[model samples]
Target chain A: MTGQSTGQSTRQSTWYSTWYSTWHSAWKEQPLSFKLSSIIVVLVLCFGVINPFISYDPVLDVELSRRDLAPSWEYWMGTDGQGRSVALRLFKGIEAFFFPGLIAGLFAAFVGGVLGALCGYFGGWIGRSLSAVLELIDTLPRMVFLVLICTIFPPSILLISIISSVLFIPSIATIIRRKVEALGAEDYILAHVAHGFHPLKIISYHILWLQCRALLTRQMIFVFSYVLFIETALSYLGDYGVQEPYPSWGNMVAQSRISAVAWPWALPALAIIITIAALLAFGDGIARREEEVKR
Target chain B: MSEQTLVDVQDLVIEFDTPKGRVRVVDGVSFSVSPGEVLGILGESGSGKTMSTQAILGLIGGYPGVMGGQINLNDQGVTYELLKDLPSFISERRGQPEKNERAWRKHRYAQMKKLWGRAITSIFQNPRRSLDPLMTVGQQVKESIQARESHKDALERLNDQAQTEEALEWLAKVQMVDPARVYHSYPHELSGGMCQRAMIAVALACKPSILVADEPTTGLDATVRAQIVHLLQDLIKAEQCAMLYITHDIREMLYLADRVIVMRHGKVLEQVSANDLKEHALERHEYTQVLLDAAGMIGAHDE
Candidate 1:
């Protein structure tokens, strides 16, 4: 009995090893940028989820006695000018911008996908008028427009995200519209039209779902990364973003200007750069795969 | 035979504004098809054989398309007038077709939507490309089936099993070797002939009154083309549906079409019965004679 149990365990171990090796080899075959971006995104999400439980109270509570402390066991990124844990604030900062970025990205994807599909599929006066309106919106100075809106309305994460998403809509819609137009001219699409399928059905099921899904996802990630950059820039400008005592990356970076130590500003700035770069790389990787599939 | 005309197209005119200026692709083309009849439009490339059918199907678009036409459909117990009030929507200025582009599109498209699929369906030239690559043959056939079938019961749709059974039946009717396998396979997995068969199955699944086949055999090999043509002939006969068979090949046209209309330079040259052509009973036009000579039918007839 003992010998039989040992033999069965050996067989199971071999099966497990074989499955793992196959999975590992498949992962290795992916593009370098895809792997890197995926890893960063996963790590960021993990940190974001565990942040509230792991981060100390230094994010909000001021401890003047521990001011400008160097990196230590208790303080991972060391303390800032106000004796707040920079590491804890950075984790909180991820939460601050991430949710809002997601909201804005989803908004752009849904609204822009529908509008673009309509404009591209029906290219008569509807296409003409829609293109005209989008082009008019495109001509506006985005930063200036954003700043004006921020000033007029009370600055909040949701409002900022929504405003930036509106500015990004025209561009996203333009890309999708071009894709739909090119696809609409294909013989298969015309055949679908001839087969008497409704225009909405064709656009959604065939055009958007089957053909343009990757492009839409890539565009969504692009909007997410863009929102992150905009948020960081606004926060860095002080007065307009999350105020002091709130643990946003921009406000933390704002606290670093007078501090003699460099870790506080450098750490958050680095986080900002790495997050945006990873998101962009992930989107571009998807785009490259899409093009390869097309070829 | 005094059968009711299923489709009557009269004085159809279609134009396009090219860089060179306005070109009338279909000029005063008139034809009609009765149930269980095959009306073949025989022409070489750029001869407007396809355009006239496109107009009848309401598939014509672009600037100034179908400028003047009257297509009347008598099918499914509904006598509908296609291209009604078309002239009211269009005006000619210095030979350029002009109108309120927005209103015309809105009105004409809404009018055309009612006739598509159930009243009139079409099989496009390239079969592989025409079938949605992403959808299985069964799914596409099921979709076309569901388009009109659900309307029969007035809200209660066919269950999945029933739809699948119907789709497989259609695949078998189109002469698919293995209906079950073909049902599960996507268009890309099938051969060119098989793809065309699937396309036929999709088009016929709705049981349309009229089927417009545009160069259905253009891309197939000799044997496959012959097989497809035979299959189409048998299916049309069995279903008793009117077909608008468009082809440049004279022999195929003569073999399949009951009545043949030979066209060139966007004008109809001759309209004669296929039996009359075979028997040399009528004095054909010079262009029709040229086509006959090209097809080597005259030599065969003399022998």
Candidate 2:
């Protein structure tokens, strides 16, 4: 038994090694710029998680007297009107902003993608019904819907993300639907069907994987931008992270609105602009690199 | 022609409904193959050679198309009345039955799930389109094996390991040297001939009883096409599997097929044993002679 088990493990490892070697070779063949951009995006996502816990306290700090201090060693990104450190606020904001958006985006993409693929792959009634639903969603004023939902429900970070994600579903579904329709016509799918593969297996194993990487890269950028926009809008309206001790870039900048005549509370606002610009620039770079890899 | 007919199709008719109205693509065609026999269907580009066999395999793509025929598989003693049922209905009959028609339909739908990569397989004309670009040659072949049998034993002790071993064997059988290295390489990395060989390896991995090859060597260079034809012939003989070779190349049909069926305008024009071509020469079916002349096999019996 022991000998057999060891031999089994050896074969399993060999299979894994074979898979790994092929994957690694493909990755290694990618251009240097794509590799570098992918690395940077991964690092930024990691930092978003780690920065709040290890580096700073984004909450529970106040100095009424030192409110709106300029950038200094004491407060690297200076302070908001509430005298909270902008660096700490930015770190925590990253956490609150990224997570809900990522979760919501992934959920929406998965639902919409599967639905779209089914519609495009097995047409006639199924395709028609899905297309009708998608078109109905597309015709709605999504931003207005988000605002109405946010007003009806409590204005928490999670609720806002869900609403924002729901708003983007129709658009994403449309993109995925077109892709699946085109891929359904590809010869590989026909060949698989000719070999008598089940429709479900053809879609899941072949069609889904064929489109997944590109879909993911596109979704990442769209979700990232939309999350930041929604968060900013909510913060400006004094609906999100509104409690005094809690810090969000939107709310921090909103506080400085009255004191535009005073010292640099504008530093937090600058941080918001800088963060958004940086993330968008970084996302674009990553998107370009992904395209380069395909080439 | 029975050495036990492996596949028998009788009175096959395929029609497609278009905006212009219904038009027949394969009108009243019938043929059969004995075990280890190669049956060639020869035609021009729009002659329905591919459609006739696709109907047999129950793989007609949605073109508002309908097929009516009786296909009998001698090994299983099952007769599939293809025209009487929809493609989905025909598919359901592959496996054992369930309690009701609905239940059986579900089972039949599930049958493709179970039978693919095992019972019946196909090789296509374009190797690049047929192969998954992302997968290594070996993994693609292994995927077929892994998909077919659920091996519960330890990986090393699994009986299905023989199937993977057979994939490499089939690759070597197709004259692919360095099968190990080729197995690890992606489809794009290989030449057209090598890709076709890898495809054959996957098709034959499960030792399917019948292999449907649709213009399998159509786009290949002459030498490569000859090699593929020879490889397929040898594999079919050694495995004792029936082959449905669809082609427009009459020379290839004559070289490789044991029996030949010529199709034109969605109908079978003539059926002849490969050995009987010379005797049939005086019976000048004009179209058939034209094909024979085009293939450079016409005799000096008449102008």
Candidate 3:
């Protein structure tokens, strides 16, 4: 009995070692852009999660006497026209950027993935009607619709996220549906059906989880960047988004319009550019890796 | 033909809608297979040899699928018609093939779900594409075997070591060189012959009474093709299962099949014994003679 137990332990160890080596090698083979973008994304996510709890000097504590103060030892960056610390407000804006996009991305991916799989797998009247509704959403003017929603409801991260998720679902669902339609014709699907596997299991696990994982990940990441852009754009328009004294990135940019020099706007603008670029690059990297695996 | 008939298909007619009009793919083709028997369906491309088997397997779908047919299976002594309710869901119309597609599909799925992979299983032509690419060979084979157990037991047996051992045994039974390595390997990693072997292992793991091999050796190389044919022959004899072997190669069919059914243009020309055809003792159709000639057997017999 002891000898048998020893043999089993050795077998398990060998299996673990082999799996670890393969995963390590795969990570090493990733492209430079993917690695860089991954590091930046992880850092941004860490800051987003941990930054809110750490209290700093208040950005809303206005001081008219210290308005337009230049960069000095007291302020790392500088004071804005409203006499608020630019760096503190930038730190607070991280939550606004990260949380809404995350919510919207998750909502869209889950809903769209299910809808697309159904439409693509069983294409009949159900597919036709669902596709018709999606197309109607697609034809509507996006900017005009967003503006209308913002005006009707008080603009907040939760409300904006929900609206963006609804808007993003049709596109994601359409993509998933097209992919399902193409893969449905393959022989593997027919073989699985003949094998007596449940159609729902095959569609969800085999088709979605195994086959279309990379495509779905890329789409989800792209949605994050889109939400970030929309939030900042609305905040910058002045009347809507986050409101005064809230220190959102968009309102911060609006505050910079008073000064002649571009330094006040530089920090927020750089934050938006860097975050969106990193997201796009990360998505592109995933797509490139998927192609390589296929080859 | 002393053993009981496992599956009996009679007067199966399949049609598809085209841009021009409706075209019949399998026009009233019929055959049956008994336990421990090999029935070869010999035909050229587009001869509907595959279509007839697909119809029996209930894998047909889309517009005008299996328009008129009777596919009956004596599943463990309980016989039932596979296409009994198809007519009720179909409606005849002028200049068009109108079908209540959703209802037909629902009915067909309900009828076939219990029998597929349990009573009947099939090995398709392209083995590489037929096997799921993401799953390991062992996992897929294990899934087939696990489907035999009760649902509650299957859930508890999800990580059971016995199924893994059983799957490895199946791999060895199919004559794989190294069962352990091949068990963990993905479908894309193996050669064509190895993939076909894995596919056969998966099909037989369920312990079904009937196996449908649709041109299993078509895309393989010459040596691999011969080896696969030999492996299939040995498995059929050992398992004592009924098989419907579909192929266009007259020579291989003659060597492997007990009886031959020659088909052309969606019709069966003749059904002859393989031994009689080999000795040129039985009367054969012109198409069968043409196939024999192409296989270079006629000249050899004459010489």
Which lDDT values do the candidates have, in the order given?
0.80, 0.67, 0.80
* Residue B299 accuracy (lDDT) in model 3: 75
Q: Estimate TM-scores for all models.
A: 0.86, 0.84, 0.91
**lDDT: the better of candidates 1 and 3:** 3
Whose DockQ is greatest here?
Answer: 3
Best candidate per TM-score, number?
A: 3
DockQ value for model 2: 0.28
Report the number of clashing residue pairs per model.
0, 2, 0
User: lDDT tens digits, residues A28-144, model 3?
Assistant: 887776677878887888988996786645877788777777788887678888788877788787777688888888888888899999889878889989989988888776666
Error of 2 at B36 (Å): 1.0
Tens digits of per-residue lDDT, candidate 3, B126-232, equal 99988887677887887777765433354565454777777778888898887777777878899999999999999998777889999999799999999999999
- Candidate number of the best lDDT: 3
Q: Please write out the lDDT profile of model 1 over residues A1-295, one tens digit for every residue.
A: 1222212111112334533543464346667867888789878778767665654455788888898999899998788898887777888877777778888998988888888888887877888899889888889987778778778988787888888888778887888899898887677777777677787888998888767777887788888887778777887775577766777777677778878766668888898889889988877766665444343
TM-score of candidate 1 to 2 decimals = 0.86
Worst 10 residues of 3 chain A by lDDT: A1-10
> What is the TM-score ranking, best to worst?
3, 1, 2
